[model samples]
Target: MDKAEKDQQDDSQDKMVLESVSGRRLSYDMKTPFYGDCRDVDDFKKLNRVGEGTYGVVYRVNDTKTGRICALKRIRMEGETDGLPLSSLREIMILKRMRNRNIVNVTDVAVGPQLESIFLVMEYCEQDMGTLMDAVPTPYTPSEVKCLMLQLLEGLNYCHKNYIIHRDLKLSNLLLTREGILKIGKLKFPDAQHQTHGIDLIVLFAADFGLARTLSFPSKPMTPKVVTLWYRAPELLYGDAHYTTAVDMWSVGCIFGELMKHKPLLPGNTEQKEIELIVNLIGSPSDAIWPGYSKLPFAKTLNIPKQEYVRVYMQSKPESFFHHTENAPLLSSFNNLKLEFPRATEHTLSLLSGLLTYNPKARLNVKQALRHPYFIESPRPLDPSLLPTYPEIRNQVSEKEKNRRAHDEERKKRLAHEGNDSIFSADHYKKRRKD
Candidate 1:
């Protein structure tokens, strides 16, 4: 009786241990093995395709188990016969390691029936800043802009402090919730949404990490063609491979200008045009202001416009003033940032200028930018909870609606052009009348 009972008990305990191991493996793993172990992708039902990017397709999905809403990103495996793409692996690894309120949270990894199809489950955000900006008729107010920018910088600061460089930082990559929280994701909120008191409630998360890279000592060279064309930094456009976190600062500056202007600050269609735009706005770069500027790979090749700064003497000071004037270049040719942002306060323009400084070394880092006076001035940054709300334009606008809007804009332009023409100027109209 003793031998039979002992043998049966041992076998039952072994089965329980195996079952426990299987359950734990399927739940969460610190190592995050991409294959096998994860829950099947079938557990979530796709609500709609939210957006698509270079590395993956995003969908708003409903967790069938908990009835929770989440964003499912299907990693692009299109030519990846060998294994998961290195970019995807990096994104997963970086995201899983970092946890910040302003950063998009990767909750779990779900696997499809086939190994090739994998998805990242993340918290659902209702809107992305890019789409929201386009849909809204008005630009963000100063306080509101401050609220958004503060969260962005906080998240970015976290990334830089942790030695991570977000190679790409742009509006589309910044996500927001219905409650006025700004999230700084590579991707929040409630009846408190109607209140003006909960500044802590609003948040901005930095989303897409596909282009992010961990900074190493004596920073290594990375691909210069990493960030989106509009938000790409000057160093990148100049083909500076051994760049630093300053590239991200330049992007943040561009984003700041976009928020103020309600459009891209330097929306050049070509690389050459982009450089020209930068030169025109901030003035051309030279060794005097930005040391080693001439040494940039493309500096000599690009036909950067040369604007001479001539000092005008007041004649009241006589020869003494003249001597100083002859050698000193005027500040006029340096930058026309004031003309561009005529309504911006002195502190605001100062912050923008600091961030957009030609020399990456001179540019403001996240911490410095956060401490700028623009944030502490009157009508200080609005609390996230008090931030205004807008329609979920990204989710609501369809391809057909977008096309229709484009057609309407085109029609309006055509009508406006015709209205300005002389009554009988058109040959086509004359011919039709003759017929």
Candidate 2:
């Protein structure tokens, strides 16, 4: 064939491809469907931003073709940048693999010029647990608390079965939907190739996927970083290299306490400060409760300023920091010294104490935690759909942790089919599912 004839055929294929100016390689942007494509701003016009979290800013959007309104999370890039942010990539990778009614849903992704800033499109929700907690005239009612807790535990359980852990779990991180479903978000950071803060971090949020590692059967020594310092378990406190899901359980306990009391039980300003509070309340750990604490890589050099080692620092803080207050209406007249659940159910207090236990092995994990009396005989069953007041937040699909989400989603499907919806769609995340 003549060059003129060959050029005509090449033009047809080149119409859909882009030849790199520097290299011989070619790349395809997307395959077009019957719906006509556009290079104009009408494709997706940005509305006002609804919320902003640690990693990026989120904006409400209008999808031109379907006229559907969705959320667009545009994470800020550092320099030209460290590629895609781990949190954004991790959420995408994990959410795509996980499918369940309870976990936040991730619908699509969009990229800006030269992939300058990656944009994630997600389902839209109106509120989060943190905002709701403040909205309600009353904190969570006994029944509402029971419902939220059940779902939270179940979701955590599902994640555990898949060998995934949400180091950052809090009320503010929970998204409540118009449908009344409560989901979690922000699961991708730890595994990001480019990340900051690892072993010596003060808390679990800092212990993002960037610090995440797999657990071997025989087990290997791990670090103390992963979960936030205040939510950290005692096993980790004493520095256990061979930590497991118990680390997360400890954070659950702290979060539970906050939900019940409307405040953090061990509200240490820093990891070191939090450790002292845990130790002061629980009185430090021994080998019995957390078997291999002494063997952890950081254990040999645990740096908490114990009273015995640093008496001056011990005298500085006030004791009222750990005091609990009730969820009911109160004034200056009500005693601040009382426990939040002043007349809290015996089992309720027991469940709280059990999880808040300093020792890792002894800490109530998701499995055993599910059996806790708090869920079995609480005032109500866990059901996110029941709560009317707390709003919900939607999750973007482009975060990391994609590899582990498949196992998590499969387990969620099994649980939902068995009628345990709350377990998979509970309170936490902060990446509960897709946020």
119-208 per-residue lDDT for model 1 (tens digits): 778888888898888888798999998999999998889888877777878888888987777776663101111112222211121235
Q: Candidate 1 local accuracy as lDDT?
A: 0.70
Clash number for candidate 1: 18
All candidates' lDDT scores?
A: 0.70, 0.54
Q: Which stretches of candidate 1 lie over 4 Å from their true place?
A: 1-37, 85-93, 187-207, 308-334, 397-435
Give the candidate number with the greatest lDDT: 1
What is the TM-score (0 to 1) of candidate 1? 0.74
